[model samples]
Target: MNAQSAADPSAVNRFLKSVVAWSALFLVIVLLAGLVDPRYLDPQHKQFLFLLGFIGMWRYSNAFMHYCRGMYFLYWKYPRMRKQADKLGDQALPSEIYMVVTSFRIPSHTTYRVYRSVFEEAARVGVPVTVIVSIVERSDEVLIKDILRRHIPDGAQVKLVIVRARGTGKRDGLAHAFRALSRQMPADDAVVGVVDGDTKLLPGCVANAVKFFKLLPTVGGITTNEFCEVEGSELIRQWHALRFAQRHVNMCSMAVSKRVLTMTGRLSFFRSKILIDPLFISDVEADHLDHWRLGRFQFLTGDDKSSWFSLMRAGWDTFYAPDSNTLTVEHPPEKNFFKATRQLMFRWYGNSLRQNIRTTKLLGYERLGLFTSYVLYDQRVSMWTCLLGLTVSLVASIIYGAQYIIIYFLWVAISRTIMTLAYAFSGHSINPMYPLVLYYNQVAGSAMKVYALFNMNKQSWTRQKTTLDSGSGRFDAVLNQVSSKIMLFSSLCIFFGAVSVLIHLTQRAY
Candidate 1:
């Protein structure tokens, strides 16, 4: 019997158990909602039916797509690819790895941990590993050297080159490292890895990714699976973990198509020749999108997105290393939960929105595969669709009764719980807090995306305390911010006003 058949009986049993558990939970939720209000199923409430359809189209459709894609990845694509990777491992390949680790003002302890992890992994790889350390602090040089001296094995062929940059931003730090690596004149087959200074690689991280290069010559870059070391409240920790869990599933799904969207900067591997290209460094240093409203603004953050775009533009396929794991140290950007979450979301969603527009315009369906291209388009549509449920709930509650809001919450709870269960089967711990965090992301994150779309040019690395130039002066920046806020406020008012009008019409019709 094949591997699938050898495990078929156990897999079937697990599937049956999941179905039973999910059905029970779902039925319980439905029964509870009915007990709260029989009007939840009132035949006369056509408005609620319309609202339900809208919610299904806007939210559930994407959820369903992710479910299907996740299953395909777990069952078909990953297993077949794993077998191929295993075969490739049997052959010898001349692969040199150059890692560029960018550090700004990371804590000394964190810096030491990151370097130790890198050097240890480099030794384990048993290849020529050159780590280009980019830092703004002169003091870190001594610390890094000491760590490398102590941690790296004595016989390991590892070299450390420290490059000091002006602390301008991460982009500048990375640029300096890339320039230094390019000066070395490495071979085209060499693998270049870019990682944040706050991230630690697990054992076999580099070796796991290198096999892909030998297996697929056309592959330009591969990103690793990332976990985090979050130091904060339980809520914050769970929130961060939940995001990574969702990210893993999404990355796996996209990798099946060999077009993973973003080669995450946390720990992404690339072809050495690509990093040496002048255009690649230039794009990474100064990448921007032309916005109709805000004009052309250089990107300040999201260097990962910029690098991913460059790879896509150059027609290089990207993959994800599911087995390669990195641990990121998370520090809260703001003291207040709401403020911290918003600032982080603003930077993240802003980068995504900026890149989404430019990538679609530049690459399009021809360059990006059909499925990947459609996913990119869906990013824009989902922004609006995600908000519809919340908006409609509020309007309907004001018109009909508060029970509508209760029913809406119940539905969200049930649906998100089901979605989170699917994620659990993907090998992540099924946190009890996941359902709440999932809903929080969908509702709060959607609003953040809408704000980001309007203020696409406003880019900043919240943690690094740096902002990108929007190709405008102080006066223009102020004006743009003010104008964007006004537009956002007006849009929100119009959306609610239209919902109110719809509710009135539905009330009269019924």
Candidate 2:
């Protein structure tokens, strides 16, 4: 079915929800700025005014991008465009296309059984398959060995890599595997496919991916569409599904059209030679260490981003195989707020910072379409616009009375409502309730950006250990703060505008 048919709506509800959310958000920002300083109109208060405005505008910029992207999807992406990708059939099966599945946290028995089944599928297709489980916990090593012995096919090359951590965190574990794998494999042993252990590969995923890699020499790697196996309770999982769909079905394709800036981490492949290249990883062994080691620069946090950026820098093309599918279990946020927020903060901040660093470096590189708009755009207005809005509203409200402030807010609310509805109705297949999600996404993001900005110096390399229960608390805090701040800012704006009008009236009366 085409995406257009799927986007049936609950538009009235969406519009109303957007009005409430946007109004509340604006109000908080204005009120908070006013409480901080009622005299923002004074010339001496310029720095203070700029600070509040900067925060509001930064939040606004983030929302505007997502809004624009949603609009892009509405007009361009529905299932009609999806049909084109469907036409590219999987062909030319290769016997030597080895599938490598990597796992870090799965229980030993489950890990073994998954590969046992996977090996069977590969053998059916006539290609050798290998499963590499990074034994994160020493206790899990025995279970991994058991899986290797029982599930590994007679002819398939099953390699068990044990990551003995002399150091702390996920970075060490991944670094250990990367360094070891680089030494063990050569450049020409066919493209190496990497998948998370939990991923259930579609029967011909490996075979079809081989066909894709063969189509272009510049094709550095490919990733498959992911669907969640676990469901229920946590709405965050659904958000992920939506995010996954947008990226795999849309952004990746767009990235390919414009030369990919970076590749996704989930289920990616690389030319084997790229791994062994002197430029990719160093030749030195960790002197009798069981696991190989690479410098932090060669092995960085957010491994997937590192690979994507490296591939681009090395002048290789990358693309996503949206039709090729991998279903994996989804871990959703618990109903708790902190757990969710913390997880998001870590993931968003960590990825953003790493990518920010990568983009800055790329500005000097010989890559096209890699320019970052945020870095280039002058935000002079952003530094004071919200504050200015607040001052004008407050002054106008006092002179003309509160009706003026209320009227202006109503206009702002109405504008947002219209945009939300227009965005939803314009062919994007997002669920009608997506605007609520969209609203929350913006408010939550503003809180995140605020936190990340303050704590930017305290960056951590280790990906946080997250489960459903742990993230809710953090997210709740963010949601509350965002809601409050936006409301506060809007109130302050009305106050300033009212005051301005009142001063003019008093001068005329005098």
Candidate 3:
């Protein structure tokens, strides 16, 4: 049997068992907590109880969405999928695609090799291409120009747009590139594709995306699914795979339902009109928010989310075509989960808040909640729930004595264990070994949650760098350091505490 269906019988049983266990645990917690203190269901605590119900309902909604998608895929779109393939078989797309590579400090050798491959890919698919290299640094201007001249295929329309920004920030560089592209693109036609320097477009990716755009006039933007492509050891490989799997699954579900809140930047194609419009244009850096001189409306934050938000606010809908995919490496293994999550918490927090604010003005309050539940709930509200639950438990312990404290701790441990198991069992539909992989993942995620909450305000965006390694277990170095430090500290604390207790016991005997 294949990996996906290898242990179907056992997997089915395990899933049923997990459902029963979770239901029993919920019943026990409710009965026990009620027996201890009946006030939990009181009118005053009803808001918290309602919040708990809301979270439960959200999960049920997600499950229902998946079920609907499966039904649609099997019954409704089964013929459509086949027909689309049959019609488009071996046909060349007519639109010319220019992949604009925007970079500031990228070295010449890297530029030549990366763009050369990109150029070749475009050529292979019969798309006439122009590569516009927008240099953020003036110093690399001559070098990048020289690299393009030597590497670009003859008559391939390779042009260089060197941009010198007064402020050397990521946003500034991207803004400069967008502005330059807007001016250079044909006023009547042309779809400019935006891709990063580090990203590699897969075979036929451009043709597929352009074809979709050609067929669907309403599509203002199209993006492919992203994955980490860097070589690594088994553990690191698993980590990257899991990360990619989780995101793609979520995005696929979102895309099919028209629910994706923000379009990613790995490889996205935009209609030329959207970028060049007077409303989207601004003199400020690309990464920063721009205040419209025409309407006094402020649109802040840069990068992918910012662009998508601007488009959505202007009444443009983004369509995600998963076939147009690419791979780019993630920031390598972090110094610790704490450092990594600290960065994520701040970015997600700020972005969530900013999006909420922006979308509320556009979509209104009630409609905004639907979007928030999908995109913002896990990053912002789930963390809030965890924090509130912990605080309530702490307060209850102080007032109701040690019994509640023991029960709360036990409840948390049991919940964590069951969630880890459920995640493991879910992985069986993909790989039998995925359960074991998820066990490691669960522990790491829980530890990161602790770290994220502790350093929630440390806002920084530095990417963690990894040195190339040609040996086994390369990313495990930092993991070992962290594990050893944790063990050493816990051992010392336990030893001193045990000694103090022994002395106290001896004095009591005397």
Best by lDDT: 1
Each model's total of backbone clashes: 0, 67, 3
User: Measured by TM-score, how close is model 3 to the native structure?
Assistant: 0.61
Error of 3 at 364 (Å): 2.5
Better of 1 and 2 by TM-score: 1
lDDT of 2 at 271: 71
Number of the candidate with higher TM-score, 2 or 3 = 3
Candidates in order have lDDT scores of 0.84, 0.50, 0.53
Q: Estimate each model's TM-score.
A: 0.91, 0.59, 0.61
Off by over 4 Å in 3: 1-94, 105-113, 138-167, 187-189, 230-241, 283-301, 332-334, 365-380, 386-460, 463-510
**Residue-by-residue lDDT tens digits, candidate 1, 118-199:** 9999888867889999987878999999999888767899999989999988888889999999998898788888999899
Better of 1 and 3 by TM-score: 1
Model 3, residue pairs in steric clash: 171-286, 171-287, 289-300
- Which 10 consecutive residues of model 1 have the lowest summed lDDT? 86-95
User: Which candidate gets the maximum TM-score versus the true structure?
Assistant: 1
Model 2 Cα displacement at 305 (Å)? 1.5
Off by over 4 Å in 2: 1-95, 98-102, 105-125, 144-167, 187-189, 229-232, 282-300, 332-335, 370-433, 460-510
Q: Which whole-number lDDT from 0 to 100 does residue 359 have in model 2?
A: 47
